[model samples]
Target: MEALRVIVDPPAADGGRRVWVGHETVGLAYCRADVLDFLRRAGLDPERVRLEDAEQIEWHGGGPGSWGARE
Candidate 1:
């Protein structure tokens, strides 16, 4: 199984929050503690951004249900 990465893109239209996939050859998910620690290290506020679970992402549109009509 392939792992997925999640990230925060800050505020924009529609509350400026978007849930999307990211590419990182290093690990599956962005370590939560690491993000928190980074924010602390950078003297930033964790509240400025929100991180969701990205360890196990589900791609629900690639199975038989997605098959096209046969000629």
Candidate 2:
């Protein structure tokens, strides 16, 4: 099976962070650890998941972005 595509967006206008699996929004995370934890809890191997940044994906063809950690 294909590894899950995990897209992590920077904080939103409301200051809430987001993660996406395909077009579905899985959940909100405050930091990188939270992102990994959420994925583990959801039965996904965080290591196998592809993490992408929303901003980069929008401008750069969805290339790999930061690992969901707040910079």
Candidate 3:
């Protein structure tokens, strides 16, 4: 199978990030687990996917450590 193109947008005013898989926007994720859930719901295995892998996920603005502006 082809690789999944995952893009996590910058945190919004509410600290939620928009998750995109390929050309579809899955949903807004507030935390790491939320992102995993989005992937899981998309028919991807959460355990097999690595959030830290740049080749797997394109995290904009900041990585998992970043959430809100206050952080």
Best by TM-score: 3
In order, candidate lDDTs are 0.34, 0.56, 0.92
List the pairs of residues colliding in candidate 2.
none
Structure candidate 3, residue pairs in collision: none
**Residues 15-59, candidate 2, lDDT per residue (tens digit)?**
447767657776876655667776777677778644454432231
Query: Which portions of model 2 miss their true places by more than 4 Å?
Result: 47-71
* Residue 12 CA displacement from its true place in model 2, Å: 1.7
Top-down TM-score ranking: 3, 2, 1
Reference-based lDDT, residue 70, model 3: 43
Candidate achieving the largest lDDT: 3
Expressed as tens digits, the lDDT of each residue in 8-30 for candidate 1 is 33323332222244542222212
Tens-digit lDDT track of model 3 for 5-65: 9999999998999999999999999999999999999989999998999989999989987
Shift of residue 49 alpha carbon in model 3, Å = 1.2
Give Cα distance to truth, residue 63, candidate 1, Å.
22
lDDT for model 2, please. 0.56
TM-score of predicted model 3?
Answer: 0.93
- In order of appearance, the predictions have TM-scores of 0.26, 0.54, 0.93
Clashing pairs in 1: 11-16, 12-16
